[model samples]
Target: MSDSSRVAVYLDFDNMVISRYDNLHGNNSWRNDNARDHRPGSGDATDVRLAEAMLDVGAIIDYASSFGTVALNRAYADWSVPANAAYRTQLVDRAVDLVQLFATSGTKNGADIRLSIDAINDLVDHADLTHVVIVGGDSDYIALAQRCRRMGRFVVGIGVTGSTSRALVAACDEFSDYGDLPGVRAVVPTTKVAVKKAAAADAPVETAAAEAGPAKKTAPAKKAARKATAAATKAPTAAEAATALLLRAIRVGMEKSDDEWLHSSSVKSQMQRMDSTFKEKSLGFSSFKAFVESQGDLLELQSKDNGQLMLRLR
Candidate 1:
C-alpha cells in the first residue's frame, strides 16, 4: 500500500469492552454480572472493577493514525449501557463518530451486522480510503476482511489477544493485538489463583519417600541457566535496538529498489511503515540522515550526481 494511505476505522465498541473485561476478570464475568442492565452514569456504570480493564480509545486511534490520516473513524455499540457510555468523552475528544446499536435480545446485539454494512457502504462511497482498520476480534469479520482486500484496500485487524479468533487473524492483511498497541499495557490474565486452586484439588497424594526427595537441577541444566543469565545481562541497549531497526529498514528498501542504492527518504519511509511509532528524532538524532550516518558500521551512505542522498547495506 502507498505511504500516503487514507484510513477508515470501524470499532465494535461492545466487542472490545467485553473482550477486555473477560481478559481481566474470568471468562464471561461481564455477562454473569448482567452488565447490560447497568444504567448509564449509575454506580454500576462507574464500577471500579470495569474501569481497570477499560479500553484506551486514544491509543487505538493514535496507532491507526500511524498508517495514514484517519479520514473516517466510527465506533459501534449500544450507548445506553453504562460500560459503553463511560467512553463517551474519550470517543468524542478523538473525533470518533459514535454509531449506536440497540440490543434486540440478551445475547443478540446487531453490532457485527451494522458495522459490516456501514464499512461496506463507506468503502463503496469513498474511493480515496486505501486502508480499512477493523477494531474487533469477532470471526464474523473474516468475510469483511476478505471482501475489503478483494477491493484492493489494505485491511488491518486490531483485537484482544485470547478473545480474538485465529481465523480472523489469517483473513486480514495485518493484525495487531490491542494490548500490543503503543501506550497500552498488556492485560495480565486473572486465572492464576483459579489455576493454583484447581492444581491443589487434583494433585496426587505423595508417599513419605517421594515427599522427602526435593528435585535438584542436573549439572547441564545449571550450566544452561548460567548461560541464560549471562545473555540476559548482556542484552542489547536501546541504541543498539534502534540501529538494528535502521539496518533492517535499509535492507528492505535496498531489496525493493531497482537501483544499486535506495534513496534516504525511501529507507526512512520503509522504517516508518515497518514500525509506525519509529522516529529518528525520538532516538536522539537530529534528522533521518543523521540517524543513518550514526549507523556507519552497518550501512553505507552516498550522494548521487544530483546531490540526492542514498543508502545501502554495508
Candidate 2:
C-alpha cells in the first residue's frame, strides 16, 4: 500500500500471459458441448465455490516486500499481437503497468534490452530501492539483477519454475518461481476444447446453458473440473456429472442403516476420502455445508459443533 512497501513488478507479458490465459480459460477448439457449458464460472462448471479459488490475484502481485522494498514493478513484453490484445484491459484492471516493446532486429530483443536499461537507470537514481524483482525467465535480466546485487540491492528473480535460469537465481539474493507465487497453486491443463469442434458440431443445438454464455458467463474451466473429478471419481459420478452425486455420496456416508443421523464432519470426511480433491466448490455448491443443506428431503442437514452442517437420511 505504501510506496516504501511497494515492489516493482516485472512481468514477461507475452509468453506468460499466453500461458495463464490458456490454462485458466479453455482454448477455442473442438466439438464438445460440455466444454462450452462447463467453463469455470458457467452454470455447468460452477464448481469453484470461492472467488479466491476461481481467480488468484495475490499470486500475480507476488511478495516483493518479503526481502526488501520494491521501488519498481515492470512487466516486459511486446503487445503487438491480437493474442496480447485482451491483456491490456486485464493489466490496467490489476493496476499493473504493461511496458510495451517491439521484437527488434538486434541480438537482444527489444523487451529485454529496454527493461535492462530502465532497471539500470532506476538503480542509479532510486537510492531507497532495496530489491529489484525481475519477472521474466529470460537470462537477459540476469546481468541486471547481478548489477543490482553489486550495488547492494537485492535481486529477486520471479518466473515460472524451471523456466527461470538457475544461474540467475543463484546470482540474486533471493529467487521465487512464478509457479511458487503465493496464491497460484498450479495451472490446470485444458482438456475439453470446444473451439474447434463446437464450430463444427453437427447441429450445435443449445444443449445446456446456451442462453447464459452469450454475455455474462464462461463455462466451467474443464481443467479445474477434470482435476476435481479425478480426485472425486471414486466417491460419485464422473467429473462432468451433476452436483447430485456428491450430495448423495455424503448422505450415504452420514446416514445410518436405520436412517439415523451422522455428524456433518463425518460426511465431509467421507466425501474427501472418496476423493481428496472433493471440495464444496468444485462441485458447484456455495460451501460444503451448503451442498449438504441442499440435499433436502433426501437428507436432513443441521449445524452441530461450530456452525458446521450435520447430516442424516430423511
Candidate 3:
C-alpha cells in the first residue's frame, strides 16, 4: 500500500445501533422495545446494558486511520430517531458527516442504498482514495465491495459479530469484528440476578421454590452471585493485554518470515495493524524496546551486527 493512500469511511449507523442492541439484549429487542421513538438519553439509550454495548466511534475511526489518511468519513442514519441522536456528539467530535435519511417504510430506513450510492460515487470521483471502508454487515454490501475491488481500491468491513453477514466478510479485503477493535471493552453478559429471574419466570411455582430452597441454600447462591459479579467486572490490566498482543504479533511475524528473529519495527507495525490504539507509552514504557524488555520471560531480544533490534518468542 502507498504511504499516501486515502480512505473513505461509510457507516450504516442504524445497523450498528440495532445490531449492538440485539447482541446485548435479546434478538429483535430494539424493535420490541420501540427504541426508535424513545427520547434521547431515555429508555433503551440510557439503559445500563445498552450503554455497556455502546459502539466506540472514536475507536473505529482510529483503526481506519492505521491504513492511511481518512479523507472522508460519513455516517448514514435517520438522525431524528433517539437511538441515532444519542451518538450525535461522538460522531460530531470525530468529524463524521451525518447524512439524514427519512424512513421510507416501517422497516426500511434506506441506509444500505444511500451508503452504497455515496461510497460508489466517492470512489469514482476521487482517484486518490485507495481504501474504502464499509461499516455495516449487511449482505447487501457484497456488490459494493465487489465493485470497489474491481476499481483497484481496497475494501474493509467492520460489523457486530453475530449480526454481521458471512458473505460480507468474504467480499471485503479485510473484516474486523467491532468487539475486537482496539479501545473497545468487551460487553459483560447479563447479570446473574437477571438470568435467575428469567429462569424463575419460566419454571413452575413448585420448581422455583424447590430451587430457592431454605436460607442455607439461598445463602450459597448469594455468595456465588457475588463472586460471579466480581469476576465479570474485573477486566484485564493494560500491561497484561499489551503483553499478549506483543506475543501474538511476534508469533505472526515469525510465521510470515523464514528467519527465526523478527525486527522490532516489523513486530510493532504488526501489533498496530492488529490493534491501532496500541501504544507502549500507555503502558508506562518509554519505548517499544523498553516494553519488550519488561516481558523478559516471554520474549528473547538481541541487537543485530548492524545495531538493529530483533526479537523472538522465548
Candidate 4:
C-alpha cells in the first residue's frame, strides 16, 4: 500500500484491438471468409465478440493486482470512432482514464506517442510510483520501458501472445500473455433446445391417478423426475473427467505451494503448465470459478478478505 509500491498501467487501445484481430484470424480462412463483410479502410467497428475476447480489461486488471496496488490506469484511443464505443463503458467502469486521440491526415502513431509521453510524465511526476505496466505489444514502447527501468522502476508488459513482439516482452521485468489470464474465457454459444408444452388430456389422467392413490401414479413420471434431480445434482460423465483433469493440474501446483489454500489464479496457471490444451471452455464453463464450482461434491470454495477465491478439496 505504500507509495513506493504503487503501480501505473498504460494501455494502447488500437494496438490491442489489432493484436486481438491477428490472434483470432491471422491470414486464415476467417480473413478470406469475412473480407466482404469487413471492407478495407472502413474504419468500422470489428466484431463485438472478437473485441471483447481480445481486451478483457477486468481480467487484465485482476491479473495486475497480483503484482501490487495499481495507482494509475490510462488508455489511449480515438473515442469518436464507432468501433471503440463498445469498449468505452468497460474502461470507464474500471476507472481507467481514457485519453482521446483523434485521427489526422498522414499520421497514425499519435496515440502511441501520447501513451509513451504520459507514461514518462507519470514516472517523473509521481515519486511514489515504482512500477509501470504497459498493456501493448508494440515495439515503440520498448524505449519507454527501458527508460522506466533505468529510473529504477519495475516494468511489466502485457500483450497478446503470438502477436506480441519478443523484444518488447524482453524489455519488461515481467511479461503476461493476455490470453493466459484467468478470467479471459471464450464462451461457446449453446444450441437451442426444443420445449414441449403439457397436453390438456394429461391433466385428467394425473387427476384420476392421484384420486385413485399413490400406487396409481405412473412409474415413468416418478422415474423421470428422479433422473432430472440426479442430473442436476451431479455432473455428467464427461464433465467429471474434465474435473479430474483440473484436480490433477491443481495438485501439481499444490505440491509446490506452501499453503493448503491456493488462489484461483495460481491454480489456473498450474493448469496451463500441466497441459496447454486444457481450457475450461472445452468443458462448457465460461470461467475457472464456474468449472471449480461444478465439482462442488469434491471441493469447497471460500472467499478471502482480499476478495480472492481460495480452493480446497473436500
Give the number of the best model, judged by TM-score: 3
Per-residue lDDT of model 1, residues 153-238, tens digit only? 99999999789999999999889888777556554432344344444643563354367685342333333334433432344677
Clashes of each: 0, 24, 0, 0
Per-residue error for 303 in candidate 2, Å, reads: 26
**Top model number, lDDT:** 3
lDDT of 3: 0.76
What's each prediction's TM-score?
0.60, 0.48, 0.66, 0.58
lDDT of 4 by residue, 1-314 (tens): 23246789898887776666556655442344352234222221223224323356766665555455677888887776554555655676578888888776532648778888899898889988888999999888899999999999989899986778899998999887877665466533111010111233356577776687763323333333344334323444756646655675455445445788878887776555334466888878898889898788878899989889899777
Model 1 segments beyond 4 Å from truth?
1-3, 39-46, 187-314
Q: What is the C-alpha lDDT of each candidate?
A: 0.74, 0.52, 0.76, 0.66
> Per-residue lDDT tens digits of candidate 2, residues 161-273?
43567777787776765555543456443333433343345235565436545533233344454555344223436443334435544434422235456667655654443
Candidate 1 clashing pairs?
A: none
| Weakest 10 consecutive residues of candidate 2 by summed lDDT | 28-37
Q: State how far residue 217 of model 3 sits from its true place (Å).
A: 28
Reference-based lDDT, residue 58, model 4 = 62
Q: Which parts of model 2 are misplaced by more than 4 Å?
A: 1-6, 18-58, 65-70, 105-109, 192-314
